[model samples]
Structure formats: structure tokens, C-alpha cells
Target: MDAALFAKSLLLGLAIAAPLGPIGALCINRTLERGILAGLAGGLGTALADGVYASLAAIGFAAFSDALARIDMPLRLLGGAFMLWLGVREMRPAPPRAPAPVRPRDLLGTTASTFLLTITNPMTILAFAALFAGLGLAATSSNADAALVVAGVFTGSMLWWCCLSGGVALARHRLPPAFARWVARLSGAILIAFGLAALLTALA
Candidate 1:
């Protein structure tokens, strides 16, 4: 494995995840509502999805790519609907209690939900493919190097999530319930808007 290529892939992963999109919002909201563990679980799910996409891109399988394209519209619609439901649930008033304790089942559910959300976006594979090609890794990298790149991406993505969730969790204790509730509502609104946009794009 080329250390330099792996390092570059790590940076690329960080850059890809650094954008404050639906995933970021979801992570923050989960952290604020259920604590850092929950947020990390969500991040883990996202990282796994990222790794999956990276592998697909690295392999450059036309059949796999074509399959993703074929179901793109359905995936978008499903993702949008799920987001709408999640946003509505988030908008509800928080009960007068501390953030819920993270149970094993809760973690599983959180991870699975975020994984589903991340995987639904077929664009992620395109983004990875573009980045790999732009870096010339697609044409030159060996199988081992590609594996390293995939690992690097997963590591980098998880690292970012750790930082984000940790930062939010640290501040969570200081914020009053009302303020937290307000943030929740705002995040919910943002999520709804994203969902609507996704639906529109899919329809268009």
C-alpha cells in the first residue's frame, strides 16, 4: 500500500464528510437528544456506507454502477419519505427529562437508520469515483492500494464524526432544556426542507 495515496484518501474522506448536509444535521440532533454514543453510532453507520461506496468506486464495476443508477429514483423517494417522518418526530416537544440513556438496541437502531439514510444517496458513489479518478488513483492504484484507500476513508469519516459528536456532547450539558428544544426544532425544519428538496429533485 502506498502511504502517500492512503494519506491523500484520508484527507479526501474528511473533505467529503466535512460538508454540513443532512448527515451533519442528523448527527448533531442525535447527539443533543440521545448523547454522544448515539451520535457516534449514527456516524459509524455513515462511515460504513462511505466505505461501501468507496469500495464500489475503487472496483469500478460497471454492472454495480448501473444497478445503482437504475434504482436511484426509488432510493431518493424512500430517503425523502424517511426524512420527512424523522423530521416530524424531531419537531415534537421534548419530554421533561435528561437525554435518554443509550441502550444496545437503541444504538443498533440509530446505526441502522443512519446507514439507510446514507446508503440511499447514490450520489455518494459518484462523488467517490470522481475523486478517485481526479487523483489518478483509479487508473494506477493496485488492489492493495485500493483497499488501503477504502480503509482510510472509513477511518477519516469516523474521526470527523468523533470530533463533531464530542464537541456537541460537551456543550449539551450546559444548554438549558428550552434552548435545546429550540435547536431541535430548527434542525427538524432544516431536515424537512432537505427532504422536500430531495423529493423535488427525484421528481424532476
Candidate 2:
């Protein structure tokens, strides 16, 4: 086990996941509306997607990489559309209610939705490729090293999500319902803006 390699990968994952993008907003909203577990589930989905992208980048599979690149525009469009739908849904007014208990089905659906959202972003693969190359893990890493990198990335991403969700959950327990509602609306607006940006970029 290359401890240094693992450590670097872990930090890389944390850095990549730390940005509060649309995905982060979704997770935070879910945390406030559902619970910590639901938010963590969403994070797990994103972590898994990151792991998949990392593996694909590390393996240097030319065919797979090329295919992903070829479909980049379409993927972006789909992602943008999905984000818009989600944003509108989030912005919809809901009756004041207690946080729902996390059920297996709910977790599964949340995880699947987040995973799809993350995976659809074609730039994720490019980002992983660029980062791996920057870190000197591009051409020379062995199979074991690649595996470790994937594991480290997954673990690190999950760690960030866990911390974020926990903190938000604590606030959820204390904050008034109006605060949550306002936050949800803000998150939805952010998501809508991001979706518009993505769509325009794809079209351009």
C-alpha cells in the first residue's frame, strides 16, 4: 500500500468534492428536509460516481474515454434538463412537516438520482483525468495504485458529505421551518442557474 499515494488521492477527492455546486446544494436541501442519512446517501451516490470516473481515467481505456467525450454535449444537455426539473421541484412550496424517517426505498431512490446526476456530467471524467495527470498518476500507476486511488477518493468524498450533512442536520434540529423553506428556495435558484449555464455551454 502506497501510503503517500493514498494520502494524495484522499486529499484530491476532498478537494474535488468540497466545492458547493448543484450537487452540494441538493444534498444540503435533502439533509434539511429528510435527515442526515438521506443527505449521506446522496453523497454516497456522488462518491460512487467519482470512483467510477477515477477508475476510467486511471485505466486509460481509450475506447471508453473517446465514447464519453463524443457524447459530452448530449450528456450535458440531459444533465441540465434534469437539474432544471429538480430545481423547480425543490422550489415548490410544501406544507410544514417533520423530517421524514429515512426508509430503504427512499435512500435507494435518493442515491440513484444523485448518482445519475453526477455521472451525467461529462466534465467529471475530464476533471479526474486532468487531476490524475497533474498528480503523476496518469501513465505510471499500477493496478494496485489505481485501486487504492479509487478507494481513497470514495472514502474522502464520503467523509466530506458526512461532515456537511451532520452539520446541516444539527442546524435542522434547531432552525425554524421558515429558515428551511428559504434555504430550499435559495438552493433551487442556484440549481436553476447552474442548469441554465450548463445548457448554454452545451449549446455553444
Residue-level lDDT tens digits of model 1 in 1-204: 588878877876886677777778888888888889999999999999888877877777454567778987998898888778878877884764667778999999999988887887544545665676676656534688779878988988899999999999999878787776776777678668877877988999
Which pairs of residues collide in model 1?
A: none
> TM-score per candidate, in order?
0.89, 0.92
How many steric overlaps are in each model, in order?
Answer: 0, 0
Candidate 1 wrongly placed segments (more than 4 Å): 61-65, 122-126
TM-score of 2: 0.92
The lDDT for every candidate, in the order shown, is 0.79, 0.82
What residue pairs are clashing in model 2? none
What is the total number of backbone clashes in candidate 2? 0
